[model samples]
Target: MRSSPELATSASLRYVDVWKYYSGKPVLKGVSTEFSPGRVAVLLGPNGSGKSTLMKMSIALVRPDRGYVSIGDRRVDEDPIWARKVVGYVPEDPVLYESLEIVEYLSFVSSIYGIDVPQSRVDAVIRALRLEEHLGKFIGELSHGTKKKVAIASVMLRDPPVLVLDEVFSGLDVESARVVKLWIREKASRGGVVVVSTHILPLAEAVADRVVIIHEGSIKADAPPTKLRELGEELEEVYLKLTGYSAEIEELVRALRG
Candidate 1:
């Protein structure tokens, strides 16, 4: 067993033999994986393939029916509050207090998380996401993309060791997406474990050090982008092939052209 200091700074997230079910339907089945420090892992899966559920498990917003998630020696399911202190999570649909201004909302997060250098960190992220202009506006009044920026800011400001971001780039514009990608790389370079899920294969290809593909409640593939794209295939092509979509797409093409 490690000391408290060591456990608090644990640099990796692990899931072992994890299983989850929704209304008697299995969403994840016997899944086991580990995310290492200094790397960015991209989770790729089609709709209803369980990517979101698996990501949610890392933060303990949802727990597995079996198995467990952990950071170093501490089990996330067993010590979720401790886990939250070390992991910064951005969900698929971020929930923020509608009536609060951007700065007030972030102040609330800062207080809740006990951030060490709250104002400086918040200022840095605000500038990075170009939110300085909207800091006084109520969170409810911002556009979806701007609101998403605030959500990203809330997590990134913490600079936590483990980050579980679900569809982070969905509403972001091109430049904001590019900036966030750079931030992701910077975070990983500093030895933070970053796991992001996205449907944009090109974006995933650009950001991922390794890719894990889930399909129908099982891990269909896991490999570095280069290996997954063997023989000069694109990441999208590889994903389609691995997830059994290539054949269906071919059938669609034939029918449409006929």
Candidate 2:
């Protein structure tokens, strides 16, 4: 069993003027941000706001057309393998092998990291996420929420220093979502960097230490959750106000009434 690498306490995820384009249409426009260990930064935005793009950039799954993304001191594009070693990403759309059982899939993922994940660790996560019954089921037979649990378990097994979760609570049930929320808080307390991108307003309100509102590929608001509350705002209100969607929503409502 290969041992996990010792991560530096000061390791951080950074984006510097990062920009990306797909077929000449801009997706990210000079996005810049830094997520440090021991903090949970929630990225909130409407559709097409480049939240997912930024998460992908952090893990080197997508490269920026200009600027750079770094995990600690290593540029993700330049040292993808190293960056991946330190980061565990749970994407919005999780992909798994249909033929493999839950345990089999997790074992395969552990092998890729060359880490011998103990049976106890696997069992613990299964119990925590209420996935024990589904462990023997094939990935193809599992429901969307169950498959999401499998994906999350695989990432958690690695115990990486950095976690980038994009809408992780989407398919989860209420109980499962609550479990994940607590788990994220525990990870943050242990000095791990956690970045979550989601449209789930309540989840953001519950767990976010810092909230970043992105609109049209740019940061519109970045502040601590307490600061927002002090200003008499919730995440939803802040998002609506910063994204300039209040007027558009009113127009839609009026049209519907007409």
Candidate 3:
């Protein structure tokens, strides 16, 4: 990821009437939304609902076929490397160099981020994620949960203004998951923009300042937790009703809200 002076002050992530297709089928159709600073937004959707695709656009991992994604003033496609510096993205499947020790890999990532994050920040991230002990271990030897923690640590180490995390709680322990929840809320409290995609409804409700339900490449509902609860008690129930699902979101909703 690279930085630019021109984009230094802008971090709001926006997708304006975006569209995407795969094999002639639409994945994200006319998706438009803006993620503002100092807020935690949770995206809830079933598999293949285009949630990941939408999150990837903010960092330029996936470009929209129509419309455009932007971070502040610069269009993501026009300057993806800079967009990356502004957004810290953690994908569902983290890409780790298995051959390297955890410490070695973090040091390499730290170098890539340059002076954007201080060594103290990096150290804090490692400590927060409880990765101190695993630093000497080969990444390949770590458990799935540990690997996930490392990936999260890598991105958080950068201390970017905008964060896009997909299935962030997958493979995490109860304590680690709690820590992540705090991370989300803390970022928003500090005036950073955060987007998190998760299948866990209760956790989602707990961390989000706003909840967005996406289905079949379109938004079914976009509102705060209060507004969502007004639709129903359980978030899954509200999601089911909004997305036209039936019976606990299984019969009417598409798939597991993963």
Candidate 2 lDDT over 63-83, as tens digits, reads 999999987778999988878
Alpha-carbon local distance difference test for all models:
0.85, 0.88, 0.85
Off by over 4 Å in 1: 1-10
lDDT tens digits by residue: candidate 3, 1-258:
432122333467899999999999999999999888888999998899999999988878899999999888889999988888778889998889999987778778767767355667778877788888888899999998899998898876767788899999999888889989998899888778899999999899899989999999999889998998987777878887876665654643556544
Across 155-244, the per-residue lDDT of candidate 1 in tens digits comes to: 776667778899999999787898899999998897888999999989999999999999998998889999988933688888888889
Structure candidate 2, residue pairs in collision:
none
Winner of 1 and 2 under TM-score: 2
Using lDDT, give the best candidate's number. 2
Q: State residue 4's C-alpha deviation in candidate 1, in Å.
A: 13
Candidate of highest TM-score: 2
| Candidate 3 residue pairs that clash | 245-252, 245-253, 246-252
TM-score of 2: 0.95
lDDT of 3: 0.85
- CA lDDT, candidate 1, residue 127: 82
